[model samples]
Target: MIKTAILVDGAFYRKRAYTLFGDISPAERAKELSAYCHRHIKDEKEGACLYRVFYYDCPPMNKQVYHPLLKRAINLGQSEDYVWANDFFKELKHQRKFALRLGRLAEEQAHFNIKPDVMKKILSGVKTIDELEEKDFSLSVTQKGVDMRIGVDISSLSFKKQVDRIILISGDSDFVPAAKNARREGIDFILDPMRSPIRDDLYEHIDGIRTKAPKLEKQNVT
Candidate 1:
């Protein structure tokens, strides 16, 4: 039987899981994700044996900063969110045949900008910044080098022939070249979009698609 490997895009899976399961703890989320990966592969095995699972993401920044929402400088490292994320990583590390590939986050100076409509209302003397929601302006940080690490790993795995099939759990189109290369190397490439829509062009690179059922959106509002 051919060996199959699974690669997870941690950020994407986390967001989709929240939409599916709601505001759950990281440990619970990890548990469900682990089951999903294994179950999905087993269902799609087509006579292949499970190889290993790889998860790629950057670590939390957990830095202290003053924000418009909090109105004070706070240490994110001391926050509940950081604690949960650390715990989640630990859980994954302990899982069988699971590898965690971590990337570093780079910080930059940024300021929250007022929305265009909010600015127009202010210019017309109809509203003020304080009248708007704090969420309207958010301080943002970007992840660096994560994509490169994923691409390099894909290339390495394909070239080394560690597994005959590779299952990538991501929606990013950046993996196109690597996927094409792997296909040329006679690897059976499959994609799992977490029940998300796949692009038209992406259909050319993969052998098959599989995903868990996404929860239906609740639209009723009181």
Candidate 2:
């Protein structure tokens, strides 16, 4: 049996798992994950020791942007700072300063202006910085903490010689160096890409790669 460690990327897993299960309960998801790993592992005939599962991802910023309870659970304190930065960015866009005269030109035209009589046209379909709701999101934000967390833990696990094999669930090319280092230390490195294409270089170096989800029909979500 291969001694295995499963390190799942939170950003990758959360989005894909939601697509599969439509729910975010980690405990419920863990059972699906464990079963999935068991099926794809290369040396299952020899049995396998699942060391542990590590999931990494960031938190959401706007509560109104997601289901209320989910928002409360998933949001991090840094989200408030990011939300404030987004609001300021919108305000700056409305101000339309610098050498650019795009907004000014639009204002000079008869098609654009602020007049009480034109309020019907403006308010009917137009939206402003202050008027925008959660839908006006401009930031492509994630919790931002997951990467560091993953890196720290991976190093620790390797240094401790915790497992003979390691499976990483990510399509981000960022993990290439770490994966390479893991191999040098005698750990079998495997990549599990959940739709996001794996880098060609990464494909060349890893012991194996997994793309298809393991037998879901055999196991149902509890």
- Highest-scoring model, lDDT: 1
Q: What lDDT does model 1 reach?
A: 0.78
How do the residues 24-99 of candidate 2 rate in per-residue lDDT, one tens digit apiece? 3444455555555556555466777777666554333433233231233333334655454344333323321111
> What is the overall TM-score of model 2 with all chains considered together?
0.56
**Which candidate ranks first by TM-score, i.e. highest?**
1
Q: Which residue pairs clash within candidate 2?
A: 10-56, 58-143, 59-143
Tens digits of per-residue lDDT, candidate 1, 96-212, equal 888998887665453456667677888898987668776565545666777877778778888999889888998888889889988988888889887677799899888888776
Question: lDDT of each model, Cα atoms only?
Answer: 0.78, 0.56
- The alpha-carbon root-mean-square deviation between model 2 and the true structure, to one decimal in Å, is 16.1
Q: Itemize residue pairs with steric clashes in candidate 1.
A: none
lDDT of 2: 0.56
RMSD of each: 3.8, 16.1
* Candidate 1 least-lDDT 10 residues: 213-222
